[model samples]
Target: MIYLQLFLSYLQIGAFSFGGGYAAMPLIQAQVVEKYHWLSMTEFSDLVTIAEMTPGPIAINSATFVGTQVAGLSGALIATLGCILPSCIIVTLLAKIYIQYRNVKIMQDILGTLRPVVVSMIAVAGLGILSSVFFLSGKFAPALSNFNIRGIIFFAGALLCLRKTKLSPILIMVGCGILELLYQTIF
Candidate 1:
């Protein structure tokens, strides 16, 4: 029964999570955190971090993580299968249709329209993570007292590095971790 539930939940995530992993964050959060209570918001945030740092898509990694937590290795396999199945089917079909209609106005228009929606979804996911990192309460509502100054400073510095330097993201992440560890040790 638990396996069935995991499969179905991930199936829904895979089916509707358009525009890739970043866009799927909200749906994954809804199922894993809000619906199943498998993980807390902080855990979900950590999961997102882990997922991003590792290989493969965020949805698949999240499904595997949640499934493993819920039901171990077998659960991870089932959840991963469920998460990829819809994408497999949809992409195959879409590929065929796109190859046939690559130049059609309607197809172009549809793709154009989807861009903003995907961007908005990604932005929402980013903001959610930012709120979780920056605020004590982890809610959208802001409070000056709850602000995490170190986190904001690190974020700003990272943003600046990305915008102004040639440093790799992985290097930036490593640097931030090292800085945080040193700060914790010294302060």
Candidate 2:
């Protein structure tokens, strides 16, 4: 039953997660956090952190972590396969279908409509990721904002480091950890 759930959960995520792996973030968060309650918000944030730093797609890493958390190693293996099964079927089906319908007007129209939604989903995922990192610091409803400027700087620094330098992402993560400790020490 758990294995079936693992398969179905990821199959849904995989089926609906458009715009590639990065765009899958919001879907994962929604299903895992909101729908299933399988992961807490903090855990989700940490999952994103580890996923970004680790060597796989966010969805796959999330499946592994959440699955493990839910049911240990066996769960992890099951969930990972669940997450990937749709892709295996999808690529195969698309490859076979595209040859016959590559220039079809309906296909073109469908893809056109999908492109914007996919793009928005990607942006929404980015915002969700940023919010998880910053929590409710930027919420505007009651106008409560308690952003840690130092941490924001560190986040920006990570981007700059990646763009301007060749420092590995792992090193940047370690550097950020060090910076967090130092920020606490100094402040």
Candidate 3:
């Protein structure tokens, strides 16, 4: 039953997550965090981080991680297969259709319309993570008392490094991890 649930849940994610890995974050959160209670919000945030650092798509990595957490190796296989099956099917069909309608104005317009929707999905995912990191309650609502100063400082520093220097994101992540470790040790 658990394996079936994992398969169906990821199947939904794979079918509906249209834009890319980042755009799929909200759908993944909806399934694993909000609906199933398989992972807490903090775990989801960490999953996002780990998924980003890994080589594959975030959605696939998330499916594997959550499956492993929930069941075991076989669960990981089922969840990953479910997550990718839609892409395999859809891309095959869409490729033929796209080749046929590549220059159609309606097709171009539809693609243009989807761009903003994808951007909004990515923004929501980013804000969700930021809220989880920077707020004590891990919610969108803000309270001065519940704000995390260290998280904000790290965020600012990371933003500054990204904008002002050519430092790679992996280096920034490592720097933040080291800084957090030092902060934990010192204070």
Candidate 4:
């Protein structure tokens, strides 16, 4: 019964999570944290952090982690299969359809419109994480008093580096991880 629930839940998440993994954050959070209660918000946040730092899609990482937590190795396999199945089928169909309609103006227009929607969804997910981490203690609204100064600094610095330097993102991530480790150890 639990395995069936996990499969169905992740199948829904995988099928409907358009706009990639970042945009899928809200859906995954709702299903995993709110609907199922498999993990708390803090734990979800931590999972997201780990997922971001690791390779592969955030949704897959989340399914594997959550499934492992819920029912170990077999659970992980079932959840991962569930998470991948929808995308596999959908993409296969879309690829054939897209190839057939590659020259259509309406198809081009639809894809163009989808680009901005995907960006918006990703932005909203980013803001949600920011609010949850930085303003969570404030309860009602985000307050300067509850701001995470270190996080802001890291974000600013990373953005600047991304714009001004030729350094690869992996290098920047490693540097940030080292800085965060030192910060945590020292302060």
Leading candidate by lDDT: 3
What is the C-alpha lDDT profile of model 3 across 1-187, one tens digit per residue? Answer: 9999999999999999989998999999999999999999989999999999999999999999999999999999999999999999999999999999999999999999999999999998999999998997897555688888888899999999999999999999999999999989999
TM-score of 4: 0.86
For each of the candidates, the C-alpha root-mean-square deviation to the true structure, in angstroms, is 1.4, 2.7, 1.0, 2.2
Residue 32 alpha-carbon offset, candidate 4, angstroms? 1.3
Task: Estimate the TM-score for candidate 1.
Answer: 0.93
Q: Model 2, 41-157: lDDT tens per residue?
A: 767778888888888788888889888998899999988998888889998999898888999999889888999998998898877777656545533233436554565677788
Using Cα atoms with residue i matched to residue i, what is each candidate's TM-score against the true structure?
0.93, 0.82, 0.97, 0.86
Worst 10 residues of 1 by lDDT: 134-143
Least accurate 10 contiguous residues by lDDT in model 2: 135-144
lDDT of 4 at 18: 89
Candidate 1 accuracy as lDDT: 0.92
> What's the CA error at residue 36 for candidate 2, in Å?
2.0
Q: Is candidate 2 or 3 superior in TM-score?
A: 3
- Which ranges of candidate 2 are over 4 A from the true structure? 136-145, 160-171, 184-187
Alpha-carbon lDDT of model 3: 0.94
Q: How accurate is candidate 2 locally (lDDT)?
A: 0.81
RMSD in angstroms between candidate 3 and the native structure over all alpha carbons:
1.0
Model 1 off-target regions past 4 Å? none
